[model samples]
Target: MATAKKLPSGSYRVRVYDKVTGKYRSFTAPTKREAEHKAAEFLRYRVDTRDTRLTVREVCQRYINERSNVLSPASIDRYQRILDKQLSEDFKDTYLEKLSESIITDEVNRLCGKYTPKTVKTTVHFFLPIIRKHRRDLELDDIRLPKVFPKVKEYPEPAVIMQLFRGDRMELEVLLALCYGLRKEEIRGLRSSDLSGNVLTIRRVMIDVGRTSVVRENAAKTVNSIRSITVAPFVADLIQARSGDYVTSMSGQAIYKHFSRVMAKAGYSITFHDLRHINASVMLYLGVPDKYAMERGGWATDNTLKKVYQSTFSDQRKRFDDMVDNYFSKIYDTNI
Candidate 1:
């Protein structure tokens, strides 16, 4: 407790007992009210300083260090970025005991607004294992996250894609994404030695993990992702002709920017990742079976290939409808 006293100089002074120093600490303010407020704030700071066991930032670092062995390098990198760049300063400095449901939900909503739903969900996932590890202190059920709505992806027509390949500098880059369904990181990670016998092995992935833009080479996203992919005859020829350590000298960011520019010149706007969707959709359109398509694309699960990647074009569906109508008409005429 602090006591305020009126001073001869016309200002009020508050004196608080300093337990550690075994002395009274005094502060002067213009008025008794100001003196009291200042003293109370100082007392609160002291209490907070003494009570803090661990900060959110410390917990995040601890989580990353403890789980580094189990988590993928990409996952570890993402968690580090979330803690460094995404989380609020107040949220990062907050003590574990002081964290509340309102605080967590507010931050989640803010993060969802800034990034994609999938990104938000993944970022929030880092908190779960950490909170559970301290279950004796925090109630995991207290924090509830908002639902992440799935987004509908758009892809360009096959003909339009073919037109863009006409002597474009990025033709090879575009072809790799559309023809092989390789991720941009996978493309950057490709080495010349990985290609042989018309098959390319996905052994490494290059990612910009932190704020510094320092790219890191790590293992593929999953064991299935590390499998080999066989290319078409033309693609195999293209790889054989290349004389470099990597498929391209361009960085991952450069590849994406150049690809976007090429697509824009062709009068369409789609991301490089959307090319993966284009590849899968074309395979489905060509009547390729799910198992073979899944194998070629290195998808461990068919649900994503069937639902997320496979999309039917309206023109293709119309053609099927016309064929069905013609068949039914011919059968009825024969009976007549």
Candidate 2:
């Protein structure tokens, strides 16, 4: 048995055998109180909770690593950046047991006031669940953690949602998205088996994981995602143009880029997903049932689309006024 000794600085030193790797290591800290507390905790844990081997950082690493095969490269990069650049710096050495609600809440508040509520909320979304999920999977109890983020923005403006859809090779995909509300991954993961004339089936997604590997056909995010969508004549033409050779890649960035070019040429600030909003807006304006639109958009719940994804009715009223006013001015060339 190794002895515990006091150094000149009033610190305590003790050697411990790591149950996991069966290695012995020495630890020195500034106080005997802390050393005894740590030592007792470790020895007790070695007997009662030896199986719970995950640290906060370790579990988080595994979650992100395993998700790489299913998430996109861009998404993986985003999650990793948050961990490596932000959360890891603060919580890397934090034992999961010591992490408290107050500590988490303080961190969340610090971040919330620092960035847009949207940006900060997303950061919370990425981390809060990650911690709890790992803890729960291990059947740990009463982990008094911080509050998860509330809903972000309540409803993101359709214009803002559309903004994310602009870019190269994105025209057709944009049309599908804005017109259909297809996610970026869903559009990129599309394949020939999902097509039959003007109807397209959405079944799988393509994701670039860890910026290194490309994984395809991981299936859609929900059961409702496996549905058929009718293609517009213009979109049909583009799809037709690519027939026999218009293949999608492991990454869908090219589709988005192409979409931006086409929208720019069409003289509209349009994007892949803007069309989705346009579709939703048009249907709502034309009085299509929200339930039907929800189904067409492959939305499982109407509340989210009505609350977030679908366009507002007020915009349609303003557009009606603007169209009438513009028509008269164009016909008569009036200044007022």
Candidate 3:
């Protein structure tokens, strides 16, 4: 339901109302013709009052339910994490009207205080569009995305990461991650049957429940994550030696709790994710192609691969020397 009213002052006021909103938000325009135009837009954004109090959690969950099937499992997992572990908590009980920019910025800042800018940015990114979508549904306008946060350049050296790998409860998990670059959930969810012929088929992942943060065995992060990796001989031996009935099964909390202890106890100033970065960097250094590394890594973008993971290798370092020797050898050898 919408209408345009002519204010005595000359500007036209366009107003729209829906059962969802219970009342109309009027848009004032400078002319009658403009009022008609604005009225149409107002009608497009008019929300029903039955739904006036849209909560972030509700909208995000609905969005996940209706749209997530189209996304790869890995991507779905990442989105779920940003929402459940971060967004859901901040906006758990908030209404869309109550969710102002100040609150969002402050909450994100607190999250950034604990995580890297890259991580905080991801967290913000996952929710911004969804929030904007809801705002549009409510007829809000000019919604914008926030700036990407910057990450610290400093990190622990590989030697330090290796030191964090101890031979104990979490040692095997960290070893699998470092050697194979499997995600933490991937490392924790391996079943004995999934391993054979020196290959491990990653078929499942565990994630925190949207509301509770409790890990549950569901589908793997993405269909692609349900992949096979040839285990290094050492890793194969380590898998064989384990006494557990399943090769890779454990509660998600186990990895989190232990990794935290190991990092704190070892003073290894790095995140668990650094293991993946170290692995990808090492593989590129060993002459693996970008495609191979990206496929093996379940990575989503080349920039992330090239900028974040790729480390220049010997080939690049020695290209000039090798080319000079091979292509100009005759010139160097000439008597003149």
**What TM-scores do the predictions have?**
0.67, 0.54, 0.58
Count of backbone clashes for each model? 0, 23, 12
Angstrom error at residue 317, model 1: 27
Tell me the tens digit of each residue's lDDT in model 3 across 1-336. 355677889788876664454766677888877877776766666544344377777777777777766764556767767777775365656777677766666676677677766777677777777776556553224333345655564555544554546456565677677666788877766767778966677776645444333333445655445556666555666788777756655556667666767777766556677778877766665666565556566664545434423443345523422332232223222412
Candidate 1 lDDT (Cα, 0 to 1): 0.68
CA lDDT of every candidate: 0.68, 0.58, 0.62
Q: Is candidate 1 or candidate 3 better by TM-score?
A: 1
Candidate 3 deviant stretches above 4 angstroms? 1-39, 53-148, 153-166, 210-218, 248-250, 264-266, 300-336
Ranking by lDDT: 1, 3, 2
Task: Give the C-alpha lDDT of model 3.
Answer: 0.62
Which sections of candidate 2 miss by over 4 Å?
1-54, 62-81, 100-102, 113-115, 129-170, 212-215, 243-251, 254-272, 301-336
In angstroms, the error of model 3 at 33 is 6.3
Total backbone collisions, model 2: 23
Question: Residue by residue across 1-336, what tens digits does model 1's lDDT show?
Answer: 666899999999999976645677788899999998888776554433333478878878987898888886667888888889888888888786777667777787788788877777787887756644443344457655557776675667755675566456666667677776788877777888888886688777777655433344546665556656656555666667777887766776788887788778877778788888887886777675565556556665645534423443246534543443243234323433
